[model samples]
Target: MIRTIPKPKKSKRHFLWLLGMKLMISSLLIFFFMSSCTKEGTISLNNTNDNIGAEIADSITVRTATYQLDPLPANGKGIMLVGEMTDEATGNLKASSYFRIGNSAISSVTLPDDAVFDSISLALPYQGYYYGDTSLTQSFTLHQVTEEIKLIDESNAWEEDEKPVFGSGSTLFTNNTFRYDTNPLGAISFKPKPTSKTDTVFVKLNQMFGEDLWTKVKSGSNQVTNSEEFLEYIKGFVLIPSGKTPALTAFPTDSILMNIYYSYTRTADGKKVQENLQMKVDDTTHQFNSLQIDRSQSLLSALKPDAEGELSSDQTKQQVMLQGLSGLVTKIQFPYLHEFVNRNDVIINKAELTIETPPSSHTPYTAPSTLNIMLADEHGVPKSLLTASYETTTQAAYLVNDLSGGTRNSTYTFNLTEYVSNYRGAMEDTKSSLYLTIPVSDLLTKADRLLIAKSDDSLPIKLRILYTKY
Candidate 1:
């Protein structure tokens, strides 16, 4: 999917920019040398002037393209994401989660002989993470997973380094899927109150389904005797989004609960009593989301993931895309860095990369709180995270919101002084580039997306540098 470009011919404007920079540096050097000349026309090389340093330049050229990476490993992320949303730039995306149910008390469920089963319900607690238009009601179906929700073959899971951090023993990616019963056990439709801590969405399961489980426990069958036996009897569940859900919502795995309701006869008091059997998520390491992105109807439709994966900003309305769930990422290349290296007289002091989004694009969906920059090889494969100076932690570009009740000044900035200083040597690999992406944790778990304007837009991406002449 990766292609290399030949060195492009410099345009007239590029030539002029370099010429102007050289002239400014030459003027400064001449002024300093002339001032240090002695009476006999001998120049004094010793100079201790602290004020003569670092000039700022914000005109460096940055080329951008939308690049697609391989599917991300997504199992056991603490949260479960589900729903579907249509995006104008990257097309439609749908998210679904698969999880198993287990309870240590299943074996000890000793219901009264006179107890009668009622119904069952599944409850999901919100994690407050949302994307797309939330004004409309959201809907999805709950299906019983017919097949065991276990990892694919361990040997085929992932590269050793790319294994899921929370997987039980193997790994699962966004591309992995499990089979579920054709008929839904339950379904739900409601307006989401993601911010309300106490608000929860519940789906009432079919009476027959609840009765079957209750009957097993009441009869003391081996299927309901122990947690391991229970898993074999009922594999798991999958939350499948309806065709036109307005937004994607998130739920914490630890808070998901399923309950079976029933009424029992109290012989001593001659009264009826109510009781319920509760089930919680069995293994957090086995829970995962299955994400599908359909870019067929958007500008990204032209991207070919297996061969020639890059879609230039020029072809995308002068904008690049950054999305989570391994959908798309923006690749950046410095086409004019050679001009700075050729002079060799100036030392790079500071370099900042500024990225902006058009205010008009901001709708109910907001940008991600942070983005990551990664170093890529000649083949466009991510190599390592770009980190802060003298630190192992990855350097992230934090979103700076526009405070005027409008998103006019929204931007993300990164300090690339170290990177720009060594860009000359990095040029050895002609196709080396930097990728702007969401954090790995979010990329594998959330559905957030962002659009970055290119150089032709009103608020285009820019790389500003501060240099000091020797």
Candidate 2:
């Protein structure tokens, strides 16, 4: 039976088997295609530009940026400039090559290369320039050349040196260097001389003498004579017992004396005579009698006694008889009266009366007189004249009574005791002159008022005085 069925449809069965094998082959082919499409590669686009060269072309131009260089360092050293272009070549766009600039050059110079540019335009890996090693990247610009900075030259701060020539511009300071040249301003002064004490004294003494009385005398206007002048005028009168009259002759010398004389009278012609007067120097008992009349026999008799009776009665008797007879005859012969019948009257009587009279009854008379005397030493020491002696002469009395009256008789006696005693006392206590009184009236009356025989006078009165330096 199998045989018979196969035969009828074998063609359809074959068609179906072939269609199943085709379907399996198609499935395997699809699996192999999927595996090949999913496999990984060794070369990456991020690793190299050649791997993605065309792909990154737009980013390359857009990423790059321009840059400027930094100014040079101090002292003309170089400075650096860095930017982004060189960052890509090294796979680090933020850190790239830099350029250096110096003072002498106007442009920036690239490090690791001598390439220079008018201005630095560089790329840096970073957005801005930062510190980095020179080998990595650097750039710099040249600084302009300039003069060095200097300090100010103030006058207060200046200093000097021996090596330099300093001018007016030089400054002053407190070291050994400089000093102040101008001196301070203004003026100067001085003092005067002195005087002496001796010169002052001499001037005062000269002024004193100018106003003195002696100055007037020297000028010849002697209105009144002074004591000094009177003393000088009497220089000749002063006695010099020391024999120094030559020395005393000078003015105001050791001794001086002065004398003045004056005459006083009542009548012009009434017997102008001097009598009964005396004088003594320095109140002495010495009498200077009859200085005008030199003869004084009666005075000598009164002073001395009758020694050896040389004045006895017998001797006196014969003397008086002879003198009386001569006096009587002489009186009768001159100016005689004729009515005398008595020629026998007294001629018989006078000779007889004398012979009858005794000599013992007769007494001698002394005349009154005056004198002034002075004595002094060389130094004007007054000398006493109390014990000194003096004498003078007597004059005859005129008859005034008539003989008819039984011969009116008269007798006179002189006493010198009171005069001597009073003068002795005056000298004892005196250093100068004594005063004497002369009886002008008494002497005139006793002389019968005769013309030449009446009046008495005095002379040359002086005073003795002592002088001493002490």
Candidate 3:
């Protein structure tokens, strides 16, 4: 030992100092190697909550790092990660969520210690790394290592007035409105009835002449002489049965008949005056088969002495006498024995009368008159079998010249006499309509049959009045 070169001045401080320097150099080399290896491999950082409070560690480990891709890389494309680490590294790292490198699609990466990253980023770098080779890429860091989190409440986010309520099993919403329910019982009921008033007037005239030889007048006065006197005139006569003698009483009470006649006499002015002078009973056809008195009997014979004398004095005197006697004589005569059969069952066939007056008086004066009889049952209803007909006659000269210069010289008549006959056997209903039609041919036939002269011409009528139920 004595011979070991004298151990020149060995000290503790120098030995410790040499040891500290050797340790510092070894640590620096290891750190540099680690940083270079990290760059070659893939640097990853945890963007999760744990990184929020983390200081700059020697390395970085990503547990929840989502990426913000500026221009997302297409499918099958490789993405690159780039940022400065806490260790002061600035090169990009090959790592992505949608794409991966060989054997590290979901692998964990370790970064070098002492790395400080300023702007970290990721992107799709190569093609054919994503499905369909799409161009989607994560190009930026979606979260920072230090960040604060926030929570939101979605309740009451929408206004109450704008919100809608949905019923069970229904997606439709309803608003505020009123609806009504309608059913059969909600319908209204209405009924109609007759509420109109009826206005009508009826008239009946009865006449009597004498007790034993009584005659009832069928036709009423042409004009009302005086309202009081006219009423008395209608009731002046009483009806009586004719004598039983065969020759004296040829007219039977059960038969329906009519009579018509006219006469002419010379007036003081030398004018021939004509008028309805006598009436002779016959069948309903109105034919003059029987006379009230024999035609040969003098009409003056029945007049008073003064009247007879005046009539026999001269032709002119006779005309004056007849004219004055017309008012006293009844134009229509019916014996009391010829009473309407079944008085209670009798029906008024019709009760219409029309008069035609001359606009100006002239020679061959012609005035027309019409009467319609409508037979009805005891209840004032029409009967089917009761019929009636009309006959019109004019003076020969009037027929030849006055009426259209003989163009309308024939007759104008109607046959409605059979419309009501058997009056007792009719329906009881009062609501019945009886239509009366005077066909053109039927009218012409009656006109021809009752024409004053047998001419080959037809007459035109001036007026027609009809009475029937509508």
Top TM-score hit: 1
* Rank by lDDT (best first): 1, 3, 2
Q: All candidates' lDDT scores?
A: 0.78, 0.18, 0.20
Each candidate: how many clashes? 1, 34, 60
Candidates 1 and 3: which is better by lDDT? 1
lDDT of 2 by residue, 85-172 (tens): 1111111111111111111110121121211111111111111112212122222111111221111244433233211111123221
lDDT of 1 by residue, 344-436 (tens): 676555677888886666665678889988787766667788897435888998988888887475898887766776765444444788888
After TM-score superposition, what is the CA distance of residue 263 in candidate 1 from its true location, in Å? 1.6
The candidate with the higher TM-score, 1 or 2, is 1
Q: How many clashes in candidate 1?
A: 1
Q: Is candidate 1 or candidate 2 better by lDDT?
A: 1
Error of 2 at 394 (Å): 25
Model 2's TM-score against the true structure: 0.13
lDDT of 3: 0.20
